[model samples]
Target chain A: MEKAIEVKDLRKSFKSAAVLKGVDFEVKRGEIFALLGSNGAGKTTIVKILATLLKPDGGTATVNGFDVAAHSENVRQSISLTGQFAAVDEILTGRENLIMIAKLRHLKNPRQVAADLLKRFGLVDAADRRASTYSGGMRRRLDIAMSLIGKPQLIFLDEPTTGLDPEARIEVWNVVKELANSGTTVFLTTQYLEEAEQLADQIAILHEGRIIVSGTLEELKKLFPPAKVEYVEKQPSLEELFLALIGKKEEK
Target chain B: METTKKHFLSDIGVMLGRSMRHITRSMDTIITVCITPIAMMLLFVYVLGGAIQAGTDNYVNYLLPGILLMAIASGIAYTAFRLFMDMQSGIFERFHSMPIARSAVLWGHVLTSLVSNAISVIVIILVALIMGFRSSAGIVSWLAVAGILALVTLALTWIAVIPGLTAKSIDGASAFSYPLIFLPFISSAFVPTDSMPTVVRAFAENQPVTSIVDAIRALLSNQPVGSEIWIALAWCLGILIVAYLLAMLVYKRKAL
Candidate 1:
């Protein structure tokens, strides 16, 4: 099968400042491909181009077998985008937000689709409440649920867990994992190394508008210095510590 | 192409429904928009009515047109603010990336402004009636006045969209309306343009608001609406077309 996404010498600029300078990358179908980058690294620029929200100055990109520039409508039909901030309508109830997206996608039964997603995402209890009252985790889950309404072949998640709590981050991670398991390709951008390490089947580091390194976790690890044979007490990560604290407090 | 056009109307309907819900839930916006204009009407009619020589028996009758215009001017500020919020919250990007008719997103806001402003105009007119304002105009004249108000709303709402798409700050987004809200004061809305100094009179007579207010005033009192109606329509349609073209250009360039 053809690649889910292919970019060749993609270039873009704002006024005189060059962003995404001749970048090249490819993503296989049904895999989690993480574009790792820090702030102002043109990660969003790349995603916007692929999603057909922005026009590129040079090069070509094909998303889901259609040129992003020439056949944007086809590419749009094949993909959904979850932006950096949770894009829920604060005034609408959680169910309404999903139904709104479902209707926009021309779904047959918008209310039923919203109900099913609400139940699946554990948001059924909060479905009637305005999204403004939702916690950060819940809102992000709702945003992801909205994106999944049309069941696009591909999804672009930009900084999906930037400000999320550890539990919420894990929740988003599980959702992404579930998406890939269902054979939907995911293209995600993030500044977190651990997020890329935790969820990505393929990781590509974007630096200075180009991909500096691209490989699997194992292949990329080989480029580092060999690990020394030493024994030390293993420390739990902050995520583990926080979860443990919360578990103890709840039990008490 | 056929399918895209088919989806456009339905897409606008969906977007419009979403925005109308925002308006209905936030009743404060409509109330806030109506409050200032109504207060101004009361102030002008009760306190300043005897002094100003507007050459009309009931000051409320003369002031209603201007008050309605002011209410619409303020009402559309919410349109800019809502669009700005969407841009900041990333919802704008999500919508843009979807496979829907893109311009429908904006038409939704524009049409919502028309409806919300219409509601404000109707409320203000009801308040004017309670204050003893009356009109000899029949149904056709009423519709003509409604048509003018709708045109004004469309023209101003398109102007609002420009700032909505391009403003860097929330304050900047809504601030454009302050001048618009105050524009009626300098026109023939409050008093006859002949009462002003020569330069001010020249401006009052020439500005779009003057023609609009005069046309509305004539239509309300069942006076012969001569050239004022044409001039008013010209101003509104001119502004509408220019503002719409400019707004679409900004939207295309901003790529939001």
Candidate 2:
């Protein structure tokens, strides 16, 4: 498979403090590749470099066959980034936000693209509401929808579900999985182990500005001693109960 | 290259649209812009105008030009405020990742500042007119007033961009404008520089605001503009070029 992203000995520093120290990784095309890291592990720095938002102090990175530093404009044209923050313009309505991105991308029909994305993201009902009034889940959905404006072949999602409740997190996960299913490569950073296990086709754990280990889920699982599996009657998880109660309350 | 130019223009338009939307949504900025300068005008014309002799019989007309400058100075603080807000949010990073022309982002804020400041000036002018501010100058002189105000706004807005990018707090971002607001007082805006002490008079007579104020005052009264217009233009252009370069440099460093 073609590689979507390639990083070699990536190094970045903020003043005297080095953030990424000789980190290296690769993400394949059309796969969900998760980078697991703790806070200050330099996941954001890596994402910023690959997205051409920041230049690496040392080493090299390429995205979609374009050198991030040398052909940054070309790389930028092929990728979209959903930053840690929502990054949506709060004063604008959801529809206006999407239209703004589409227009910025120089699409021929910004209005139609915005309308279609709003419907696809199940945000049509809230499309005219200002983004500042949106629920956290709605804002995240709008953010992802905005990123897909130009139908970029590669996407960088930096901590896509950091503060979300389970239902909202799953909603974002579904959107991410759909992107990969449609053959768009996804590079995401996360702090949740289950998130990596559930969605990623491959995972790399980043520790202290370096990828400690990387492999497919099953391949990494083999490194640990196996325990006997047992089946029991499953109960509704607390998350599920919480979501159900919230849904009912809103309905009433 | 042709398509790139086209893309740059379109991207600026789109970003300008976003900034304009924000301006319309926030009513507080509009109120603040109108109230501050008009209040200063009313206070000086009623209370202080009687005591301070500024060579003109109608203090409102003499004070109107400088108050317009003050209004613009105050209005541009909002530009820094908005730019600081955009910087704090990750939108700057998102824009950095986009393929659009890099300068378009700054231009959007700059253009929005020009538009909003122009509106604030117009509102202040209308209030001045209501309070007996009049001028005998023809179409060309009126155009000159607009032109000079536009240049002043352009110059100061670029200066505002510097703090907006580098400031750690909102107060820090906006504090730069206080000096700008105070500049008119030290110059010939309220009282003539001749009435001041020697050192104070020297500074007031040589500063940028005095020339701008004198030029506008001359144009309003149909007096010969003479060299004050040239000096005012020189000051505005010099500050504009320097501030533009410094702001862009700071912006590039912060983006990293």
Candidate 3:
């Protein structure tokens, strides 16, 4: 089968600044491929190019077997983008936002599609409420639900949980995992190492516009010097501590 | 090509429906757009009307056209503000990445501006009627006024798209309309240009707003609309073409 995404020496620049320089990567179908990088590492530039929202300055990128540059409409037809910020329309009710996307995608029975997504995403109770009143987690879920309206072959989530609370971040993680389980290829970018470790089937670390390393979690782990066995107490991470406290509070 | 064209219009309709919902849900935007122009009409007719000589019996009659133009100017600022919000919120990017026609996203906002501005114009006209403004014009003339107002709204909305697409801040997005809102004041919208000094009068007579205001005022009064209507159309079409080109250019560069 053809790959979900393919890139070869993709290059892009803004003004005189080179944001993406000779980048290369491939994503297999039905897997969560996480592109890990710090801010300004060109992860977003690559995603934008593949999503057909931008034109590459040089080289080539293909999404779902269509050239992103030459066949941008076909590329768009195969992919959906959930940008860094939750793209839900604040003034629109969550249901309306989903329906709007369905209509734009030329789906039949938009209302039914919206209703089904609302139930699946656990947003039925908030369906009629304006998205402005939603919490961060609810808004992100709504954004993801909107993106799923047309059921594109691939989805690009750029920094999906950058500013989310720990619980919201976990909620997004579960949603991503659920997407992969259902056989959708997900291309995601993040600065969180734990995010890549937890959800990615394949991981690529982007450093200064170049992929320095690409592998599965275990493969990347082998790149580090062999670990000498040591007996040390492990402290709970802040995320674990926060979740525990929140879980206790909820139980009460 | 056939399917693409069909999707282009349908996609614009869908996008327009979305923004129209925004306009309807927040009726306050419509009221806010009307308040300034309506308030100016009230202030001028009641307080300043006795002193100002606009060569008309009812000051509101002389003032209605300019007020309509001003309302449209203020109304399109909301278009800019909404577009800026979309750009900031990433919804714009989401739409761009979709398979729908790329230009539909913009046409949606532009059409919304026209409809919302039309609503504001009608409301102000009702207020003018209540303020003792009357017109002798028949139905054809009334339709002409509607057509001109629609054209003016389309032109200004396209101009608003420029700042909407490129503004660095919310303030910058809407600030472009301030001068537009103030433009009618210096034209024949307020008082007759015959009473003014040369330089200001020269500007008042030569500017686009004056011809538009004069043409609308003539149509409403059932007077001869000779060259003024043509000049107004020329101005509107000229601005519409130039603004449409520039806005599309900006959108292409920004999106790509």
> TM-score for chain A of every candidate model?
0.97, 0.93, 0.97
lDDT of candidate 2 over A1-252, digit per residue (tens): 399998999998888988888998889999999999899899998998999888999998989888898988898889999999998999899999999999988889999999999999999999999999998889999999999999999988999999997889999999999999999999999999999998999999999878889999998988889967999899999988998998899999
- Estimate how well candidate 3 is docked, as a DockQ score: 0.79
Docking class of 2: medium
Model 2 regions lying over 4 Å from their true place: A228-237, A243-252, B1-3
Candidate 2 per-residue lDDT, tens place, B76-97, comes to 9999999999988888888888
Best by DockQ: 3
**What's each prediction's TM-score?**
0.98, 0.97, 0.97
Span of 10 residues, lowest total lDDT, candidate 2 chain B? B1-10
User: Each candidate: how many clashes?
Assistant: 0, 0, 0
True-structure RMSD, every candidate: 1.3, 1.8, 1.3
Better of 2 and 3 by TM-score: 3
In model 1 chain A, the worst 10-residue window by lDDT is A69-78
Can you write out model 3's per-residue Cα lDDT over A6-121, one digit (the tens) per residue?
Answer: 99999999999999999999999999999999999998888889988889999989888889989887888879999988988999999999999998889889999999999998
- Candidate ranking under DockQ, highest first, comes to 3, 2, 1
Q: Between 2 and 3, whose DockQ is larger?
A: 3
User: Candidate 1 on B100-166: residue-level lDDT in tens?
Assistant: 8789999999999999999999999999999999999999999999999999999999999999999
